[model samples]
Target: MPERVVPGRPDGLITLGAADALWVDLTAGSAVPTAFGAFTRSPARARAGYVLLGGRAVTTVRASGGRWSVSVGEVRRAAAELNAVGTDPQDLVRIGPFHGAPWQEADEETVLCWRRRIAGGLWEPGRPQRAARRDLDRPYHLAGIDWRQMLVERTRDGTQRTWWLPRAVVRLLDAAEHAEAQWLQASQTHQAGAAVTGPPSHPRRAARDAGGRQATDPEGPAASLRPYNGELKGQLYSVLSRKPGTSRGVAGWACAVCRTAPAAVLDHCHEHGYVRAPVCQSCNTLERPDHLYSNDIRVANRYTRLFHTDTDDWLRHWHRCPGCRARTTLPLPHLAAWTAHTACRSLRPTHRAPRGRTPCGVLRVSWTGSQNTPRSCLLTVTVDCCPSGEHRLLAQVPYREAVERFRVWLAETAPAVAAAAGPDRLDGLPTEPRPVVADTSGEGLALF
Candidate 1:
């Protein structure tokens, strides 16, 4: 038996014309396996996100006892619609799981959907039934049609969905050539010269930047006119709080490494490549080393190049891992980041982070990496001299971290440092959550 390989789809949506949509029914069934008794809820687990547009929908079909049955009138009508619908980048046509509902009734329900044509591809909701040659559940394509719009309307309002085909009046997809009537409208209106919607307005660059390198655009597709960092950094880039302040005037934590007031650096271990608490500048750079540098433009570039592609051919061409022959299931941005910078997050440095030099407390952050390896970074700290002592950590410049986890860690540990620091003039510090022994071992930490 030949080994079957499932490819990840990256873009586009498939829709059927309401008036004629039998062929669409057959095509839709090939993608949806559960109708054939093969069930799937989330495509993300079995397939790649790149296979489906973030906001697009595809038809689903099912089979029973090794065969699918549909009305001859329905098939003829769908075949006519598949050929007649007019398509364009701006205007799209959709046809469906007959009427959009997935339930197997004596009569079947189908959904036809459409979306923007930023990407192209074919996708299926299920798998082929056994080795049967005439299996109607096998996947096919909407050759010669670049569908653009798909809407979902329930039949008489039920949990089950039925599809409505738009643009059923004309033929859009022909033998092997795509004819997008709506897109032609857009071309006519916008001309060959125009900026894609949104910021970073500039003419598209076909290749690398001035120094012969990849250019990054933080905003999106059309936002690459100016210089932008792909590697995230700085205040705007930071997800972790980088400083300490007494908001309501009560302190609970002692700097884990410094043994002084205000445990602002929550779980300040460099092994994890981030700071949980608000960090003092010196401690963050020299004492603790848990920051990542990123430029959104780079991420955006990768996303545009490889995510949500709709065509199988495109998937095969672009999603291969340069690292090895292994087919990649990760998004293009993630793959690019990994390829470009080893894409390691929550990393530890070769140099040791200072534990604490003076009367101080200590905190550790532990988390897993993509490889599932336990990562441990360090942050050495020093304390401020005075009755209201302050312990601080430092490390090299630049920081990067996950936002939510860092926030929770800080909320948990900041109080300890605040109580240790004692009373101060800074306002709005919390007076609650009495100080308790700080847990040096990080908890509730995982790589998302």
Candidate 2:
């Protein structure tokens, strides 16, 4: 006789089997019993060595003569786990422990035979002969079980036991069993209802047939026309009927802006309360002016430029500076002028004129001849800090080196000066000076 390997605990075994072969044995006494009212209940023990049924441990027996009983606590836990895996435990039929010798020869044939018998309950007689084999292969393949790793252990007591199966294999088997049970129940229901059938009638169709009417049949368009109070509908019908070429069936008119989408709304001036033209819903909602002046063509043109075209054109033409590559909201010409003017003004004050008076910063750049020539082109940047102050010259440098010096000052020197002065001192600094274009055309130079 093979060694009788009693699985886990012998006392309270809950055997789950199919076709007289034990498949899963849940140990009912491994966990301590909790007292409820007069009865004591034992929870299902989750042993790590065995496969998990729906993520809960499934203890199996290798030997015969173990007490087979299903406890309420064990059933509940199994049911909960099964429900989590989308299988209803109510659909499965619980079978008892059947007498069988322990598996002594652990080979492919033995393991395949055990699996076939256990899963054979899901196979119907009408199925192909190879259907059981396919079903057995499905779970094994899906679970990724390694047959090479499976070992048969023999204990000192001469009992033989099979190795632990994978958890995925157990879940797949449980799911297949559930599906088979549901199919059987559905087949039974169909057979029982076979005597009472013609084609079934829908409740809605039956109701409609009985009353000989539909909700929209008598007054769909006519009911909708009533809300317009007859006058507006009459006016629309008369106008559309008169202009047959313009009305063009139900296909809506084109949008004025994009000229592609069908116009689905009446665009109108909110101030004048008059319909302008039919426009697409998108154009009507998005392109409407925030506030409109009188409905003149000039006003309309101005609105188009200010609201739509000008913004897009400005953004398209904008580019970062070549020297500093800094982004500014100001236009290119304005930014170039501002940059050169700001750099010249940051020079140290040479002479103090008066206290409590706004100081004027000037940048005089000579464009023509040498650095010390008398007949060179003079470009003066007079930054007036006060409203009532006369222009005074501050700093002078050659035009060729002014921009380079400004760029260097901006990159290396300005940050340290601004940081040391802090935000409060900087705030007291004069506002940005506007560029003053002088009459330098006399010297053959244009102030940009």
Candidate 3:
């Protein structure tokens, strides 16, 4: 047997920025699956939200069967309105399911449905069957000639059904329908543009930037023009045109890396060669070609490119935190301050160590790198003895490697140092969870 392919799951109400909806059989007093086509579409999942029905807010309830539930009495009056309608023989352009007798003398209670358009016109009704009163009272799912505007029920028994929506029900759901229509239209337009332009190009750097040359200086002004490279030009145009918060070509947006700086340049990951986000000139230079840096941006194992306009607010408000390893905390306001604070913390003995050990001979720890520099090319750890004031040079390594070396030294060598320092000194390493602020400016406090 051949494997069956399922269509991708549809976007939810949250992604669409609209109120969630659920299908309900008002007469039966229960909810039904909102989407059909178990074979054509992915498995359905229950969503939570309220919908306006019969002039009342009907809260959505997830049932044990992975469906929704509702009260019959709450929608009984509206059910009558939907059920009372019957087949109108006088109407020339009939579409969707209809109830009542197709001709005089036929049982009025029988259910009759018109087949979809065939040979440019709707076909005659199929064999009339005596339907349960509850089936007749089920509300019509709203639909459009060109776009699917309402719920479509596809049964596993190889049957499809949709009904005609009354004017009152349509009026109640006007906002949701309009929003869905706009989303569909935009998606179609995007697909058409992709067809014309060919597949989008992946992010790559200029030959000079990729060949081990240092990035442009941080103080220099960011490049305002779109990327000149042919491969990047098409993708840049598409991203700028679709990215939200960007109006008049990047004027309305701020850089994602540095919240305070204007978004003057597009930043892409050096390792993966894909656009990450818009960033300021300084941040762009700070990102290394191999992603080796002591900054917060390097913490994420993977970075996401903003593709949806609706996700602009989320990107602006959330960021990955290097201190706590939390991916959604607010960004550190001062990168330099956070780096210095983290370096100091790495030198201290962790609280996991046993208490009552003698103080370590290592009194003061200092590094050689300047705080203002974007990259710490090398880190030099030196310790100064207290009374003798003798300075001793220790290991020198890359900044990130130095941090780990300090952790290992403190764990293994610090206890031996306490014995060498003799019993005269009583000061012990501080083990409190409270972080020492790097400066008086009160920056980088969110890490704690």
C-alpha TM-score for every candidate: 0.15, 0.16, 0.18
* lDDT agreement with native, every candidate: 0.23, 0.28, 0.29
| lDDT, residue 306, candidate 3 | 19
Q: Which ranges of candidate 2 are over 4 A from the true structure?
A: 1-341, 346-357, 361-378, 383-391, 413-448
lDDT-best of 1 and 3: 3
Give candidate 3 regions above 4 Å deviation.
1-252, 258-260, 282-448
Give me the displacement of residue 72 in model 3, in angstroms. Answer: 68
For candidate 1, write residues 168-237 as lDDT tens digits.
2112211111112122222344444444543331222111443322222112111211221211111120
lDDT of 3 by residue, 1-448 (tens): 2221123412111111111121223223322112222111111111322223321232333323543333333234334433443322211121233343212211122111112221112223353221123322332332211112322222212443323332222222332222222223333565666678876211110012322221211121122223222223213333444676443333223456445444434553221122445554334433321112223222111111211222232232222211111211112222222232234334523222266542223423233343223166354444434233443443444545543443343234333322233223223311221222233211211221
Model 2, span 1-448: residue lDDT tens: 2112345633333433220112122212212111111111111112111222322223222224532232233334543444343322212211101123212111221112234443243334675211233433322321111221221222212432122233233334333222222223333454455537744322111113433221111111112111211121112322443564442221234443434343334433221122334443334333322111121000112223322354332222121111112211222222223333445436424335566533344332222332223245233443333333455444444444454454444335334322332223322212432232333211111121
Q: Any idea what lDDT model 3 has?
A: 0.29
Global lDDT of model 1: 0.23
Q: What is the Å distance of residue 236 in model 3 from its true position?
A: 11
